[model samples]
Target: MFTRPASDEYIRYQNQYISIVPEGNIIELLERQQDDTVNYFSSLNEQQALYRYAAGKWSLKEVLGHIADTEAIMSYRLLRIARGDRTALPGFEQDDYIEPASFDTLSNEELLERYTSIRRSSLSLLRTLPITAPARRGIVNNHEMSVNALAYVIAGHELHHMNIIRERYNA
Candidate 1:
């Protein structure tokens, strides 16, 4: 089983999300989370998918899109770090991404398809990494990060959003 990342592997602010993940093999957790996420979103009806808990909040569709986008970005970072790239990567503002993507334009089914496909691609890439990959380190958003921490962030970020959906969106 893969071990949990050390505290120093990631920045302190990310701990809120990372701490949400239970102890286990992170790859296994990610795989299970993909299925769980897909299932949860699939259960929502059109109206439910569009529901936002309050004004100025993202709809369910936006949340799913955000999750997929985050996975893609995190996985990209993982790939680069695993490949021994020491270059510093820039960080993206989530709100900037959300505003232009027009996530709400697509049906829930389409959003799910996009989400599942991206997650599957991430899983495939992760499965092929060298054993030493997780120990690799790089800079992102000006913060030093490890490949293992990126994996945990990907999973934990999803869990964080899922909790928000359950509690706020009531989906």
Candidate 2:
């Protein structure tokens, strides 16, 4: 089983997200989360899925898109680093991506379908990585990070957004 990442494995800013992940087999947690997230979002209707808790905040659809986008990015980083790639990966602006994504144009069902597909791809890639691959490190956003840390960040980031949807959006 892959172990949880230690503090030294990632930058401090990521700890806020990483800390939310419960101690366990991270791959299993990520796999279980796919269903949990899909079920939770699937429970919402069109109106609820479009809700924005406050002005300047993202609507539910946008948040879902953001989650999908982030997962794809992180998983790609994980793949590269695990494969012994040493190149520095560039950072992306989430707002820039979200605005152009036109997530609102897509139905909630469609958004969920896309998210599920991306997550399954990620799971497939992660499952194929060797046990030692988790320890592989690479530069991302100018900071060094391990494949394991990125995995935790992927899971914890979703948890963060889910908490926001529950507390702020009341969904």
Candidate 3:
């Protein structure tokens, strides 16, 4: 979905808000992110998973699990929107998504595998997109979004969490 490139002002604003991984190829970013994400999670041991920087923050494992889950959901959004679907998608509450999951018991390797698989599929689909497809507008979570923007947002979102894992989890 090719649209005109994002305005320099908009790009600069987004850059200030999120430290995007420097890779311009979205496919490479998604693939390489799996490795980076896995490394981040694998560095944590059980005790580290339970450690929290603050009382209100999530533990390391919980944050990793959340990233795995969020990738699944977000990748699905990318898939649907890239297919040219215009239907509005539903939003989710992270608390609700995590409530029943026992993050403490899940192995970091397992979580990493799950995340990697999701990214593999997402990257494959993204590679098939015509240049113009990403700019196609779609409704996700009741909000309008361009598929191109969502791809950038997905990368940024992961970058944000990776920062949190480093700064907060120390794992």
Report per-prediction Cα RMSD to one decimal: 1.1, 1.0, 3.4
List, residue by residue over 3-87, the lDDT tens digit for candidate 2: 6788888888889899999988887898899999999889889888888989989999999999999999999998999999999
**Clashes by residue pair, model 1:** none
TM-score of 3: 0.83
- Tens digit per residue, CA lDDT, model 1, 1-171: 246888989988889888999998888899999889989988988888888899999999999999999889999998899899999999989999898999889898999999989888888878998888888899999999999898889999999999988788766
- Model-by-model lDDT, in order? 0.89, 0.90, 0.70
All candidates: TM-score: 0.96, 0.96, 0.83
The best-first sequence of candidates by lDDT reads 2, 1, 3
Q: How accurate is candidate 3 locally (lDDT)?
A: 0.70
> Best-fitting candidate, measured by lDDT?
2
The C-alpha stretches of model 2 lying farther than 4 A from their native spots are none
Clashing pairs in 2: none
lDDT of 3 by residue, 43-108 (tens): 767776678899877777777778777777877777788788878888778888665888777777
Q: Candidate 1: lDDT over CA atoms? A: 0.89
User: On a 0 to 100 scale, what is the lDDT of residue 102 in model 3?
Assistant: 81
Give the lowest summed-lDDT range of ten residues in model 3: 2-11
